[model samples]
Target chain A: MSTDTAPAPGAAPPASDERLREVSRVSRLLSRPELGAVVGAVLVWVFFAIVAYDNNFVSWATTAAIFNRAAPLGILAIAVALLMIGGEFDLSIGSIVGFAGMTIMVLSFPSDGGGFGWSLWPAILAALIVALAIGWFNGFLVITTKLPSFIITLATLFIFRGLTIALTRLRTNRTQLGNLDEVEGFALADTLFASQFEIFGARFRVAILWWIGLALVATWVLLRTRQGNWIFGAGGDANAARSVGVPVNKVKIALFMTTAFAGFLVALIQAVQFTGADTLRGFQQEFEAIIAVVVGGTLLTGGYGSAIGALFGALIFAMVQQGIIITGVDGDWFQVFVGTVLVVAVIFNNFVRQKAAQR
Target chain B: MSGNGTPLLEIQNVSKYFGSVIALEDVSAFVRAGEVTCLLGDNGAGKSTLIKVLSGVHKPTKGKYFFDGKEYNFSSPRDALELGIATVYQDLAMIPLMSVWRNFFLGSEPTKGWGPFRSYDSEFAKRTTKEEMAKMGIDIRDPDQTVGTLSGGERQSVAIARAVYFGAKVLILDEPTAALGVKQAGVVLKYILQARNRGIGVIFITHNPHHAYPVADHFVILRRGMVYGDYTKAELPLEQLVQMMAGGADLEVLQHELEQASREGGEEAEALAETAQAIESELDELEEKGND
Candidate 1:
């Protein structure tokens, strides 16, 4: 019985040579999914830092500006990453941003400006409620009707954008809402959403802090919570997860809501900073957020990604967008650079995932 | 036999219809604690549909379902889980990219702390996963290793261990050994025995009589969506069980037809008759041994 119980063929390892084992261990670490994003971020940072040396692109002020520009996209990308990992997409997120900003603007603008003349807090609350409702509707539709979120949210994307445009035109007779700075209680809301602080002699927007905070919280939730486990299971294989009693539908719905909430946050920040809202404020933002998420090493098919990877991805985007101008390159090349980076990042992520699975 | 207790789960005269098609018809089986009820069938024998009904993925269109001798209706797999019926699907109910410990505690995670501060207890999950697997005689190199990297047999063991550790009173495995090699199938069969030894009723669904005979305490043979035969281990020997599963009556008819064809003389007919005679002798030898 004891001899029969010996390890089955291919079950036991050969005698371990310490050096070879150490080499394999290091190789395993290098093949982690996020390694691609980390490498991409480093290469972009170094290249830009060298090329734009004359512009002081490496200096604190320029770095702060880059991060400021990356902040909103970073926040949205993190939420989108979570959604993607949970096996869904929200093409309506950009429209949600525009709708949310429009909500805040129209509700807070003075009565003379054909607005509700509401105080800043009420307007902010109303905007948040609307964002939440849109998110819930998207989630409900996907779960109850069993349709792809891509198609459902795509339809809502146009519907919401059209509603924003029509609502603004009907109520204010214009496609823009302005004069937010003069609204009652604007100062407090501004401080909360659009304030700036000095850090190491660099002017940093509060949105950067919000971005970092959300990323940290997201990472913690994904790595340390039961809900995070459910998210992964839901995305990986819904049927398998359902067999084990994981509430795959609920997890997906919550992820949609989280993405929408992130959109609202970004819209609120942009609205406060500009003291107005444009009907097309968040045009194409949905694609950009998804690009950042993909660049961060999240699988397009879902069930695998990291919040920190998304942070690095957002950082890479900011560097390229700002670095191109600082280096005296044609602005058109920014799009080219972004496209190249997206392709390379996806290829690198695929290679890493394959390598990691090999062992 | 089988602890001589009330059935843990009983499906009586269950019939399932999907639209105008019959997926399962008049299938009945009872599983008792501390025993393994092997549901054997060939492909298209409604084994999958029967397992789905038992696991609460579908409700029988006509039948009475009983758990612990009381009538029960489960609307979803979640409801079945609440009643201590855990299912180990053929896919192993796992996220391939996740670590073994994470997959082990996928749905029913253990949490520490209180309220908002409460979080998954990673240490406990890892330790428990490793310990449970070890109890089944599986030595996992690392709990943090992704499940996708594990071999097919290892994945099946992990799924079985998970079901046992999560307080399952009855375990339903859907073709657990169907995709495995001979040795890997042996590994899963060992785990099935381990689960049964722990006083949990196990429903082992498979088509292979060789894999089922070693551990099964009771056998329910299904054919064309209905139960063809039911027998305890003492009443059904391994050869007879294999014969039943392979549709013995059909094989007998084929042999008779070949013998008749042989009388109408040709080289091909003579060859067919020779093959038929060989099979007849083999069956007769087995029957003689069975009598002995």
Candidate 2:
């Protein structure tokens, strides 16, 4: 409602009205969580830059490698971030990655040849279908049974892990998949995953570009798309959203599928690029993805997060992971540092969320 | 009733029950373009059930409803919304974390492009939201601001503006100023008038009679799940309306008993008199409270 009173009927409008300007000023700073994250990102970048430059750790190659490694994680983080923003989580994504890769590898193998025959396109398609189905199953349980996602996805993680073990044994009595060089469509699949290009005298993999493109699309959807708006509404207040006509369950299901699709994409990339799969593949990808999204300023409680922030969060994560190696720090200590960052990022994000919620 | 402008929504002898409890009975209301109808009742007086019936959250068990003068039955709120009946609740029926423009176009968002891959038109949404808010005499600074950041009254205004922009011919508001500061309540009341001036029929539901007294073309009062009275604006007497809402002669008898005890010269009697005085003041303050 307008704070200013309405103009009297048949009366001349005021010439020097300034109420509109005041309201415009107040509404400009909308979501504190995202704005704080943007500022925090810049500050973190500066701090890291100082550390890198002081240690003579600044190099174009280092930067490229950082992005190259962070790219896949960034893609996964975007997916997880969207899910979190839409008010759910997927602990099963880690297992989904393993399952998707294993599915592709086993399918590529000729059943009679005792080796992966590698009909790449069909294998990839089948893997994707399986991953989507897994996502749908997760959603179905979440909606129908009305269980918390944490417990649902935890059950899924174990189930998928156990299935992987049994399926591997049934295939070749071996825990690893191998010998898919003879598969049809391998070249096209390989190119999509393992291709490289040179930019500004720095070589980067196709996956990094893919990550950037995905981030761009995600950013647009979050800020400028109608579905993106529904994600926020449904996550923010499911009952309120529904009363106003938002389809809460559908949005959540779509988010789950998106997360699964991201895992599937990552699995395909890893398989085609490395040309192999193992039972243990992607064992902790879900935690890493969640950490990336949380550090990107997404709330654990759902609603109020940005895709770009998630990408930067992933960037920070990869920077630390690779920067430690470049600085000759023990790789084992990297996990400890990641835990600390997660705690700090969550605290900062929560503070911003609180500030934003206040009138 | 607008003769040519047929009632957009009409409920005839509606009755609703929750298991064995009767929520509403023999209730009727009509909404038409170019007017505001105020529904007034105390808490537990069946206002909510009545609004639910109109909004199609629940179908009345014993009534016939007409939309655009055609008999209608709705299975869900979505069905009612599709027929251009929008209900803005006290909470504004919006996601607080979402930007104003985004909230303005939540479920029925305007999209560009084609087919399943169609993209939302951001520029259009922002521009149109800004224009509509301005038309409602609201001076919101940015369409990108989250609705949470706006004042409670502003959020209510945005919801009203959204409904109007989306072509809601019948707007049902439930206690729009029930939880607001005095100024904030005035702000929402102004928006109610704005909606009325726009020729969109409005059903303003509230417990506060003063809120309904000024702007309502018709007033319908409910008590214990049934209509106590219904009157055109000209037929309403403010004093009589107040007394009726205060339980008529029963309250007067209680006042007499308290006065008799006061004359007996006991501390308890004085306390009772003070209590009676407090009630009298509350009755006087009802006008002020209703403004909020």
Candidate 3:
């Protein structure tokens, strides 16, 4: 968009415009935002496949396990990726998870045993409503106060987490709520949230379906829709988007709410699977999701990322995390691996973008 | 185009105030279809403020604003845009990472299908982008290329072409040639004429009289929030336009003041004398260009 020289009219185009003509397949591949993540995922999977072959990491059961673990985080990462692309961060989702989970447990458990004893469906609905409200409030604060969402969501992270602790302890006299499987609609809730089905002799959780399904939908929305263009425009330059008649504030607020919904979904999945809820559930999951998003090729600075990229990021993260345990590597090396991969992925992303930009 | 037909845009006695700052006072300008109305002014001469008032970013404190001869009050830029007025700002409201087609059809993206299934009409967008750019006489090799890949002049041309494609009856360009090299400025100036030839009333805002002279059918010269002169091409020649754009007489007075101060003969006064000499040569150069 900026070069000192003007593009020569017709007789002889400048070298810069001429350079754009060399659109080789390699340059074509470099322009995709997900290229780095896809390449990194392939390398990581190959290295892991070779190293952990003896540990049965090659089996379908391991695939199911990896996906199950990756699903919850991946689902959140997809939504978080969208938010990041829209140019905001939600540190509140990690705490939103705890709050929503507690909301379900508190409302559904019998009051005789220090619970409201409400039906599971209502409790689930209520928690989702609260989650969206929290998301709205986070966006409202960020928008109205004109503070960076980093600060606003960070504040809500503690505020919501504290509310979960204070409210749960006030109602139950204990931070942890257990035996949620005993709730009235637990059977239905469990079926919907934690149902496992065998596919080729390996059990797969429904959450994996949610994650992949959401990833597809998000990818479509990001790449092929007008809203997608607005997202990029909003993140790339808010004032520019505003001048062009894009509803930037509304897009951002909706994105924040989407992350909260993601938190609620993850909370339901975990609560149903574990048969319990606690104030400290999903601690640091927000940061973990951000790491996944960044690794997925979504720019931390926003405007230049994709949900599919984020999904691959989560996949790589989950593979490495479970790979360490499966291969008998020290747990301490997990963070080291994650840290190194993140930096490498970002550098690779930048290198590819800059290279593409040169042409 | 102006006296024979109703002007496409007419602002009479427009005055704007930011708590008595008087950004624009008693300024009147008219833009006629198939005519280029160049708003030429130096810095702080209310060029931006007048564009803002016209585009509805700021309301005129007191004025009768007319579009196609109908008195109109625009509360927002969208209102003006919907009424066939489009402002192509200096920044051009473009996303550098997005493709040319994407940025070209940004706010008004074309979609296929309906509801959630509706998708960006990629084929139509790309074809239209290319066709539009071609119409402007700039051949785009690829619409998929990001706008950032284009040169500054090309980017400005894209914005102009986009507005034209979207049916902007009145095109407002803010400093279209201000930051461009000679060839680039000529590129933008050509587009301004192209837009006018298409019967779109173009308000080409700039401080450079040289860029505006050849293309402009009408000139609205502003100085200190008021119209210094408004003239037709025949009424104002290129030399006089350039002289008026700069404070031609005021430059002489400033030179005189510097000469008087240089009599102190300190090191700083010597620098002032040198600065005055530089101004004298610049004025002389302007005089030389004025003759031609």
Candidate 1 ranges beyond 4 A from true positions = A1-31, B1-3, B252-292
lDDT of 2 by residue, A244-318 (tens): 788899988888999999989999988888887887888988999888888888888887788877888888888
> Model 3 over residues A1-359: C-alpha lDDT tens digits?
11012223453322245634666898788778888888998898888889999999888988888888899999999999999998899999999999999999999878987889998889999999999999999988899999999999999999999999999989988888888888788899888889999999999999998999999999999888889988988887788888878999999999999999999999999999999898999899998899899888888777889999889989988989888989999998988988898889889989888987776
Q: Categorize the docking of model 2.
A: acceptable
Error of 2 at A312 (Å): 1.0
lDDT for model 2, on a 0 to 1 scale?
A: 0.80
Q: Score the docking of each candidate (DockQ).
A: 0.34, 0.34, 0.31
The TM-scores, one per candidate, come to: 0.89, 0.85, 0.90
> What are the clashing pairs of model 1?
none
Model with the higher TM-score, candidate 1 or 2: 1
Ten residues in a row with the worst lDDT in model 3 chain B?
B283-292
Tens digits of per-residue lDDT, candidate 2, B74-161, equal 9998888888899998864778778898888888777777665577777667767777888998978777677878888898999999
lDDT of 1 by residue, A192-298 (tens): 98999998999999999999999999988998888999998898888878777788888988899999999999999999999999999889899989999999999
lDDT of 2 at A5: 24
Task: Report lDDT (CA) for all predictions.
Answer: 0.86, 0.80, 0.87
Off by over 4 Å in 2: A1-56, A112-118, A199-203, A349-359, B1-6, B114-118, B249-292
Task: Judge candidate 1 at residue A345 and give its lDDT.
Answer: 91
